[model samples]
Target chain A: MRIERNGAIAALHGHCRVEDAETLAALLWEGSVTTLDLSGCDSLHGAVVQAILAFQPSVVGSPGDEFLKQHLVPALARRATAD
Target chain B: MIDELLAQFLIEGREQALEAGADLAALQRGPADPARLDRCFRAVHTLKGSADLLGLTPMGRVLHAAEDVLGRLRGGQGEGGDFSVLLEVADQVERWLDDLDTVGVLPESASAASQALIARLAGDGAAPQVAAADDWDGASAFPGRAGVAIRYRPRADGYFAGDDPIAIIKAVPDLAQLRVSLAEPVADPALYDPFRCTLVIEALSTAALPAVETALRLVRDQVALATLRAAEAFAPAGVEVETARRTLRIDAARVDQLADLSDQLVVAKGGLIELAAQAERGGDGQALGQALRAKQAELDRLVAALHTTVGQARMTPLAPLLGRFPRLVREIAATLGKPAALEIEGGEVEVDKAVVDGLFEPLLHLLRNALDHGVERPEARTAAGKPAQALVRLSARTVGDQAVIEVVDDGAGVDPARVRDRAVARGLIDATSAEAMSDAALVDLIFLPGFSTAETVSSVSGRGVGMDAVRAAVTRLGGRVEIDSRPGLGTTVRLALPIRMVLAKLLVVESAGERFGLPLDGVAEIARVPADRIFPIRAGRAFVLRDEVVPLVDLAQALGAEAGPSSDRVVVAGVGGEPVGFAVDAVVERIDAVVRPMAGLLAGARGVSGSTLTADGSVMLVLDLAELLA
Candidate 1:
């Protein structure tokens, strides 16, 4: 519910949870969402992190939470670069 | 220039490597636990993330492959071979980290090694099956957190059964650090069923175990609970946690600078004491000298405290060095077809970094000797009424100011008769001398150069370096090695090393109008032998000390200096286990000093180990008694 899709870009806001994973995955699977903006996000569930890992989405901006920005963001970004 | 981030990464990378390796070894030992597999996955994932950040593509590739295999194993679809491949990857990553530390770059062959390991891991991942589920008892995953740890793996059909796994965990009291992951790898997002629950959720709560258990009563069968004791919350699975101390990481060079400043302060304080002595000698300055002496006493106490603090700053725990031995022991045992286990104790004991760094090679050699020669074959062990599986214990403990490390094996011990015979055959000693030697003396011959009791040279240990090398390496660190063996029982090799290497007690002596220092530990006794008590020997002067003939060497002549005017003072020191007397002009006062090893042109200087600053700011050479005798 925290994800707003605009064409090829999906902007995530506030705290993202397990419920948001299915929608993110569906959008990623549809070959529409290529870039994710985590600028406003403060926390992420492990499932949401997994979705980003699997789809290898290009990430822009940064998370508000230090752990997410420093640890999770780099981990997620690495997958995209690796692909 | 070394990047601060890169240095931090190296420290963390080594820690994660050890963590992952230990977890993988545990997983390979018995029934599979998904939670344990998940812990291993996270450790590898962290390393890969850091490697990627540092642009270490080769290390990242290997870790990524390892993560995939662990994911599959967590999904109940992995074989036993996958664990070994992952362990190898962990070791390879550790070696790469070491290379990166020394050269600030990975080796050129890292890419090839990574590719080979990835291929092996991929091959092992091809054959998958349902792994048996075992209870996860490790509370180490929730480090520094005390409470009930909940590992909830909801049934795959639980979503249809109206069970919300996330809501169930969220209702627990004082929830903290919730982690969710796929119980199995998502094969394809296109075919993924969103409604089918395939998640493993783990969390910690401050609530009591019973309260948490009651909260998860509806899904009790799927949840595992464990109490994380507060005192040991930060320790690994088997390591004993010492009292927690707040620590800050500082560059080792900065610590050395602080120690050097402290040494200068000590010398200045010594100068003040000497000034007070001069003041007391003046006719009308007795009261002034008393006040000066009082201030000097206070300064002495302060300087002593500062020295102790600086010494503690240089202390590093032995865990980092000792952690890798268990895996090494396992691999060697497998290679030799000898089933053995290594139990390490007192790894938390802290010692000077120099001692810790210097101990690795000698300890590795001793461990190899234990595995290769001391431990008997499985059938041979059984025949001797011992357990089929050999146990090799590597333990460390602090006794007074020394760190005593022992590598012991529960197998056939050294046969002194065999050793004596080997010595005779090798021409190290004559048959008559060998027969006259006691069992203890014969066993000591193993430490002699070119000595090996193994009839055939094995690839594991007998590459020419033996216990003699171990002794030499330890001696360079100002430590000693002792060995004790029983005929049928096993052997114990003890390495008693000084906890602090910076500070030393030296006995100042004057010979030929020049002052020198002798290590106080080496000097057995000092006596004023009469001129008649000493007699001329074939090569040197001989004197009787406690009914034993001790050969005396003139200190000045030994150092190529002119003879001293007086030779009455005899300093008896035990070199190579025999008393040798050094004749000097006079024995000066003993003082605590820091000795810096000879460097530059004097690095290869014989008979002089190091130099220390005297109270008068003069460089006094600290003699190496063993080297002098040799």
Candidate 2:
């Protein structure tokens, strides 16, 4: 329920936990989801952060959670920019 | 020969480490000073040379990697490199020196520690056990850096046992970094078990060792906690040796001035000796006495100059103490996931070494509190029409003879109402008194012992001691701390400390037939009020002084001594912007004395700042009226 895929963009909402990591990873692994919109994300579990780190997807929209917005989002953005 | 060389190496190594660390911190603060960068590079290079000379291979390896990184930094390359890792390398080297000084050799773990540090400095993105999951065994995942490194490999049946590995790792206090990977690669896709939990969770927590251990207690067998040899982890509560080094480097000019004063004193002594011989010969006694008086005056002048020169030699710039905070601030901010930047000013301002040394713990606590409780999260900050990145300024400046240090944060200023509620809930004050207290007084309640507004105890700042400890430490340094909060605007905590601790002007007063010294700077004025002018106010008493009713506290009663008849002498002192009068037996003469901080069993005695010996050789306890009234 936390991950909604529409076309090539997948939007994550609320708190993304370990259970959503599999769906999110599968969506990214299938080579269809190119962008992740995290504007509505309140927080992310460790597994969720790890999946994002591993997949190296293009991230868009800042999360509402301070940790994700300040640390995780910037990290993801840095990698994307580097690529 | 080797012992002497080792001693010299330890001293020089510590100096180079401090120099490099401070310069690196300065460079990280932007507009990178080329001179500082070059100096840092050279310092590291020198340290590397010494390490090699001493055959400290592990230290040499780490320093060589650091030197290379600094080399890149100097060449205007590798701008993306993390300065915190470099700072860690410097800290690790300093810790090794400490070990070498104490144990005569680096610990056996130094090699492994150096490798981890070298990997971090190499910018390889793969520290031994940090990111390289392939090499991780179920056991032996030593900490790659400071703080507690944890490896959690939940059993395959962990899912069935209702164990949530991710949640367990998430619950760790002050979790700085987390990495997840598969425990074992699946040989075949067909053989993969859907319900099996093969997740390996590795995390670095800034929490203390016991806290991490307790968090992983349930999965103790499946978890491994390795505490890295970190400066903070080892010291935990005070400044590290690099910042609080006892050895002082005084300017040659000051030493020359001191030598001149000593030479003048010697000449003055010769004059006195000639006058003494003239008196003994019974030749013109009056002229001999006049000559002796003149000689004594000259000696006094020379001694005063000498005393001042020595105090100047003891003066140390605030940079060494304040420089280390930027890296620590970054670490704490990263750990808390807060977007905060620390701007330091007046690092060049000089203060007595004692003041600088005693200030580190309190300043660190204040910064921690600012990041942990003062700064709002990015979302919250943005919603409040503020910048996502919070700004905390650590500044110092001289005000008159006092050094004023301030920690100002543009974050969610403390809510006095919430503080009042917490104070009442914690039984620090009655509900009626809390409601009657002013907003400023309500905010000041945060400094009351055992008072904390933190909803949950975070490892960052909520480790039993609260703002009260900060207040105590500052007061112990002959300083007074004040906090000003503007609801949602911001908060500023200011500490006004004496520039020098060697000499203090104290107003001697007698209470209960025993004499005490009160810092004259804190004493506003002395007044004598007739009994008719004093009237009972609230539970105590007050007197009208120039149309202002200042509350009165009997000195004897405040110090737990039996009160004699209340005298008319009232000494008014400022406490949190209000005048409070202390009635003592009599107003004695003011004298300039050196007040030594109390030690031994009397160190923690309440209401006493320090002790000073009187001209009669009697020890007088200096009363901290502000603390006593509080």
TM-score of each: 0.38, 0.43
lDDT of 1 by residue, B319-416 (tens): 76787577667767887899999999999898887687667667877887898899999999999999989999999999999999999998788999
Output the lDDT of residue B538, model 2. Answer: 82
Summarize candidate 2's per-residue lDDT along B1-630 as a digit string, tens digits: 457557766876788887677655445433566656655765676677567657799998998888778767766786534455566677678888999999999999899778866775664545433443233321223323556667777777776676767668767888776655566554553344434677777777889755886887788657655444443322211112234245677889998998888889888888877787788889987787788788878888888889888989999899877876786688678878998999999999999877886686678789989999999989999999999999999999999999999999998999999999899999999999988999999999888866888897564655434687677667657677899998788999999998988768788888999989999999999999778988998899999989899998889999998987977988998877899998999877676666888899999888799997664345799988878877
- Candidate achieving the largest lDDT: 2
CA deviation > 4 Å runs, candidate 2: A1-83, B1-97, B100-246, B280-282, B502-630
DockQ of 1: 0.12
Q: Which stretches of candidate 1 lie over 4 Å from their true place?
A: A1-83, B1-300, B503-630
Compared with the true structure, the alpha-carbon lDDT of candidate 1 equals 0.75
Least accurate 10 contiguous residues by lDDT in model 2 chain B: B232-241
For residue B161, give model 1's deviation from the true position in Å. Answer: 75
> Mind sharing the TM-score for model 1?
0.38
